[model samples]
Target: MIFRTPPRAAILAIAFLLGAGFFATGAAPPSASAGARLALGGVALAFSVVALRCARMRIVASDACLKLYGPLFNQAIRWADIRTNVAAESGVDARTFGVRTPVIVLTSDRKVKAQPVSSYSFSGGTDTPADRIAGQLEALRQSS
Candidate 1:
């Protein structure tokens, strides 16, 4: 199984950032130099690259191991190493937005960590998809 960043999240963020840049550059006063407008466009391009990097994040699960792919790195965790999987609220956005994203948590003897590459936000309710995925992964762990 493979889990990916939601397409809607990526598209909306990228479009809004790029649109703002285009509007700012296009509406710059006639007195503004070409360099100023180009700078705004460059900033927009940089933001777009970050958004694209985030959107490409994913996790792949196989019988032997689970593979996580992020913007800058890839990691594999063997099934034998993961003691269990559970659904948990992530505090990453909770403090400011009051929205705690649900993610799959993997616990081992050495560490308890959340799956960093993939999170489910709009799939039904806040916790439904995360719970389902965690349950499935736990089942996989038990069988293997």
Candidate 2:
């Protein structure tokens, strides 16, 4: 299945940033307010771009290996390297995939190092989509 970024999130981020900029500068409450607005606006803009990019998620499972790529990161996992699929709760606001976080923890028979690839949360659909992707990965692993 294919997953793409949510346009509404990007639009909202831009709009909020612009509106905050205008209102914060217009008011003379304190310079801190302007700075704060600018900071928040910057974060919003950055996240918006991330959201746009991470919106795309691709999962391809073959007997040889499993391939997964979304906007934020990409990985190719061999059947022997990946462990069981784990379901997790995540959300766009929380910067996690859908309501549940979907992740595949890599493992090896010998001592080895592993790292978690953080998932992107850009919209309400993040968690659920991630779970779906995880499901795909598990299916692939089983088939292999």
Candidate 3:
């Protein structure tokens, strides 16, 4: 099964707002500060495109392995390498949004390596539940 990231409309909305601010006043030639604002707006717009693309990241699970696709990182774990899969909350409140979301932690035999799967939603907020994905991963590990 393939699980994809949720739609990030806020990112795109911010980008649009920033872009609109650049031309809201008038179409006159841009001054130095105006040019800077334009550049910043362009950067935000570009970032939105990248974010939208990355938001399509997929977690692919097959009989042999599970793959996690992210914007900057990708991880693949074979069924044999997986020690256990559990759903847990993230520590440290990484997003600064005051919401500490749940994540699926994948433990391997290696002591130093633990993969956290944050793509799955467990709060009955998203269509796919973390328990279902964890269950599938556990089954795969057991069968292997």
Candidate 4:
């Protein structure tokens, strides 16, 4: 089964607005320097890509393994390799915006990986709650 986070409209909107702003300002004669325009365009493009990747973040579970997909990272853990799955609030303030966000922590033999699965509110596009995902992970570990 595959579970995915919800589409974050705010992030998408911000990306779009940033791109539009760059284009709008780039059109002005005083700000039309090629180097500056290119720099702004590159930043906007990066933001758009980041937002798109974040919106598409998901977790895929199969009989043999679990896969975590994120904007900046990806990991796969075999069922046998999992020591435990824990659900807790992440301390990262940037992602939380002052509110605590739920995170799924996967403990394996070699390392611990933390993945943010839900936002503080419904706006975060968490299709499945972190605790529920932890439950599913636990079940998968048991079955394997």
The TM-score that candidate 1 achieves is 0.58
The digit string of per-residue lDDT tens for model 1 on 94-139 reads 3343222324344645543333433535433445444555666677
Model 2 quality (TM-score): 0.44
Error of 2 at 90 (Å): 4.6
Cα error, candidate 4, residue 31 (Å): 2.8
| lDDT by residue (tens digit), candidate 2, 1-144 | 333224433444466555555544543446466567777656655655555444444455666766665545666677798777765455344344333455666785332111122334455554544455566656766777
lDDT of 3 by residue, 62-128 (tens): 8778777655467787766666765433333344422222243446345211222343333434333
Best by TM-score: 4
Q: Give the clashing residue pairs of candidate 3, or none.
A: none
**Model 4 TM-score relative to the real fold:** 0.67
Error of 3 at 1 (Å): 1.9
> What's the TM-score of each model vs. the native?
0.58, 0.44, 0.53, 0.67
RMSD in order of candidates: 4.7, 7.8, 6.1, 4.6
lDDT leader = 1
Better of 2 and 4 by lDDT: 4
Least accurate 10 contiguous residues by lDDT in model 3:
111-120
lDDT of 4 by residue, 1-144 (tens): 886545343454466666656654554467477787777677767666766666667778888788777777788867776776655444444564422233334453454543435444434433335556666666767777
Candidate 4 residue 90 Cα shift, in angstroms, is 4.1
